[model samples]
Target chain A: MAGTDPIHQFVISDIVELFTIGGDGTEGSGLTFSFTNSGLFMVVSVVLTTTFLLFASRNRKLVPDRWQLAGEMSYTFIANMLRSSAGSEGMRFFPFVFSMFAFVLVGNMLGMFPYFFTYTSHIIVTFGLAMTVILVVTIYGFARHGLKFFKLFAPSGVPAYVLPIVIPIEIVSFLSRPISLSVRLFGNVLAGHITLKVFTGFVVSLGALGALGWLGALLPMIMAVAITALEVLVSAVQAYVFAVLTSMYLNDAVHPSH
Target chain B: MVTQAFAQEAETPTEQNLDAAIDATRGEPVEGAVGHDPTADTHATTEAHGGEHDSGVFPPFDPATFPSQLLWLAITFGALYLLMSKLALPRIGGILENRKHIIDADLAAADASRQKTDAAIAAYETALAEAKSKAQGIADQNRETIQADLAAKRSAVEADLGAKLSAAEARIASTKAEAMTHVDEIATETAQTVVTQLVGDVSTDSVRAAVAKAKE
Candidate 1:
């Protein structure tokens, strides 16, 4: 009965009280600087990613050790993904793309632990990431191609008679990239966690009914274990999806035609 | 009994929560109910903490936490980007590049050594062939020299044997001539003796003439 509320885990609670600046730090009040569980996890993600990468590269062996190989593999994975989707010129944005990938992946992995806040489950966080990608695409597209960047919506091969219908659809699709990107990740993580919690809650509830209850609880327990494994896979896949999509969007900035 | 009561109490709230969730989805508010909606519970908790902005919303959908979350994200992500670009990526790339260079250099060295070995083998074969031909030439020269010496010695021996055979034939001819002379002498003496025994003496010239005439 205690952990039955699937929504309880997502509650944001402040760990340290800092200051309320403008109004009262409420809905429309102003900005609040107090460090919350979300902030702590963000800090944890940054530290963990930095330490792992730095420690892995410390040896610089020709025949790499396990940790070093792991580090190199992650680097190559993201680099190749960006280069293939975008282009070699897109290597300019490698730092940004790599950072986004590592942050999301590490954050998702950290959230797998009990009592850890999943930052990617929040729409604002994923939206912030998606918006940053869009902003880079838009700003770089304009800076690089000027007025010709609009050619993205009008694609080259379409018949002139269908331009009127095709242009708006293309524009809508282009504009919805950030929304789709953010919502896809957030919805997946949110739903997966909630489902896992609900199934686990069923096990606890059933186990309280004496011997018969204990026997019935086995099914839910198995289901909960299976769902946990699925969630782990989902977390990794979602992180990869975020990076791949980010590269594809950045590709538009590099080559805006088709 | 008490355990059973507790189990029943837990089950009742779960059923009520499910109904409240269904009702909330239908856009109908359940009135005069305590802890019926889970979001309401979250709302009460936030309100109790004097946070006015997220009082009646799901925590994820609440707008009040956006500013801090964004600020922290920018800080942490920016830090990650700086650390990676400056420190980690370049090092790994360098290691890979260095390994490639070393392996290539090693392959080239091995190729050069293989060529050297091939050249040495070819030289060794040439030397062996030359030695074999030289040995054949030496053997042929020795055989010719021995055959010539044998021919010379055989010719000298045949000449020496021919001279000895001629001398032996001359000696044999002389011995035959002497024996024939003795035979004639013996015949003359015997003739003389018989003549004397029969009737007085016979002359040597006559006897000789008679013998020569008889031999003729």
Candidate 2:
């Protein structure tokens, strides 16, 4: 079957978005409002997580079963991650970070299936998520530190005369966070999917063959399976990476050294 | 109904020890005795009878379940901690206490046995000493009689020996006199014979002279 227009399929048209309700000018502008493809996958991910947790908790044995142990490990892991990254100074934000973690984890997972659209592949979705996190840190930073957040762009080591040259560059670097965040996630996921698709096409297109031709088919097939497993790991890693970065920004916001 | 009651009476192995302890304290008769009763057990009986259980009990309970899996999980964990605290922990503690009591009783019994051993050893020693002293007394009594008899035999033998010694001395003196007489006679006879044989026709004086010369 023919593929959809890649440009239109995973392009960012409108600017603003978010999952959780927060004090913001734009809430769910593009995909979060309706029962779209992205929404379906989000629902699927939540349902799956809920089911697994439920089954795991049902027995309630002192010595946990395998699934229960996994659930417990995951909870502890995320909790510890939050504790280390955000520190005790920012514990109230744990649920939000955890929620974000859960959302991306599911989003990445849903995209991995064949004939499925990677929500993360879309820049708008990723940008919107990053912006929400960035926006939270920004607002909280301003609230807690007042006007002192401007110091985040200016370091102490730079000479007074160098402020004119250095401040703009720092400000641009700091402002480019959402762009980098969105692009990194989107590019990795899209590239992974496209690579898989291209290799898979070789497998089918190459007719049944001899030593050289069989290898041509064999290599790509192996790569496809390998990439699938890798994607699972990468998906979890991305979520963790996102959460950690969010925490760092929050840390910077709360305690701005420069 | 009888079968049902008997079946219920066949309590689980896990519960028997616990039930036995409870029955003991409650002044109830032991299980399998003549008056053993399934209805006697308070806890199991109460649960089975359920006199206070209403039909509307747990009305909001839903088997299909809401999206409260996460919430239920938290509740489940809390409930488990409670069960460990209330039921499982206390039973284990009671078992440990009983084991300690059994060990203490065994130690006390061992101490009593050691004391008895000590007493027995003392009694055996006292009997042995009395036996040894009685044997010594018997030996001393026998030694006195033997010494007395030995002295009497020695004195009688000395008396007999004195008489024999005198008789031997007398005999020796008489024998000595006779031997001297014999010696003189033999010498005179030998001289007469010798003279007769040497000089048959010689004169008496000449003979006497020859004899005197021979004697010299």
Candidate 3:
């Protein structure tokens, strides 16, 4: 009964009060500068990512040790993903893509631990990341190709009659990219965590019935364990999906064609 | 934001229903009802605290935390990007490049050494063939010089022997002629003496003639 609140885990509570502007930070009415659990985790993710990479690459051996290999493998993995989705020219965005990937991936993995806040589960956080990607793509596209960046919607080889229908649809879909991108990650993390919490809650609730209930709790316990594993996999996959999609969107900025 | 508000509105009813269901189950009259009451009371109080904390809004959809979260995200992500670009990526790239260079250098050195060995073997074979031919040439020259000297010495010995044989034959012929003349004179003298003794005071001329006729 105690752990039965599935929605309670997502609560963002302040650890330190910094300042507030325009209002007293109540009823979503003010710009609060308080450091919350979400901010703490963000800092944790950054520190952890930087420390691991820096420590892993400390000894640059010709025949790399396990740690160095891990560092090198992650480097190549993001590099290859970007280069394949975009071209070698896309490598200019390597730092950005790598940072995005590391941030999301680390955040997701950290959330798998009990009592850890899942920042990626928040729509606003995911949406901000998605919007940043879209902003970069748009700005770079316009800078590089000028008005021709609009050509992404009006693809070539469309029949003249279908162009009227296809262009608007394409435009709408294009406009929906950040929404879809942000929602996909947010929804997956939110739902998976909720389901895991719910199942785990069932175990606690049923086990309150004593000996008979303990036997019944086994099924939910197993389900919770299985869903936790699945959520771990989903966390990694969603991060990869975010990075890959970012690269592909950047590709449109670089090429801006069908 | 509106959709999220609607979603929160929609989710609250279900959560309340689930909470009610849990409470109903805990409220069920069991053998250990007396013991379960205290635990149920604690659950109710904790639920109240959770409700106050959440404030009827889903935490993920709560706009109050957005500014702080976004600010932190920007700060942390910017720091991560700078660290990666400035430090980690270049180091890894350099290590890989260095390894490739070393391996290529090693391969080139090995190739050069193999070529030197091949050249040395070829030179050794050529020198051996040259020495063998030179030895054969020296042996042939010695054999020809010795054979020429032997032929010259045999010819000189044969000419000297032929001259000595002719000279000896001539000397024997001359000595036999002289002996024949002497023998004729001696026979004449002996015939004359015999005639004088037989006839008293016969003439020398007649004796000589008779001796000549007998000899004839």
DockQ of all models, two decimals each:
0.29, 0.01, 0.33
For model 1, how does the per-residue alpha-carbon lDDT over A39-60 read when each residue is reduced to its tens digit?
8898999899889988998988
Model 3 stretches with alpha carbons more than 4 Å out: A24-28, A156-162, B1-53, B108-216
Predicted candidate 3 versus true structure: per-residue lDDT over A1-258, tens digit per residue: 336889888988777767777875453357876788888999999899988888888988989999999988998999999999999989999989998999999999999999999999999999999999999999999999999999998888887889889989988988999999999999999999999999999899899999999999999999999999999999999999999999999998898885
Candidate 3: tens digits of C-alpha lDDT, residues B14-107? 5454454355354464333222333334334435554223444688987777888888888888888898888877888788789889999999
**TM-score order of candidates, best first?**
1, 3, 2
Q: After superposition, how far is residue A135 of candidate 3 from its true place, in Å?
A: 1.0
The model with the greatest DockQ is: 3
Q: Decide which is better by TM-score, 1 or 3.
A: 1
Please rank every candidate by DockQ, starting with the best.
Answer: 3, 1, 2
- Clashes counted in candidate 3 amount to 0
Best by TM-score: 1
Question: Against the unseen true structure, what C-alpha lDDT does each candidate score?
Answer: 0.84, 0.61, 0.83
TM-score of 3: 0.69
TM-score of every model versus the real structure = 0.71, 0.46, 0.69
Of models 2 and 3, which has the larger DockQ?
A: 3
Q: After best superposition, candidate 3 residue B213: deviation in angstroms?
A: 47
List the candidate 1 regions with Cα displacement exceeding 4 Å: A17-28, A154-167, B1-44, B47-54, B125-216
What is the per-residue lDDT of model 2 for residues A1-258, given as tens digits with 9 covering 90 to 100? 223222223321211222322334332222232223443444565566555655655565455678766755655566678678767776656555655666667678888777664666655566767887788888988998999988888887889999998899988988999988878887787777667676676676553566677768887789878988888888878888887887777777766753
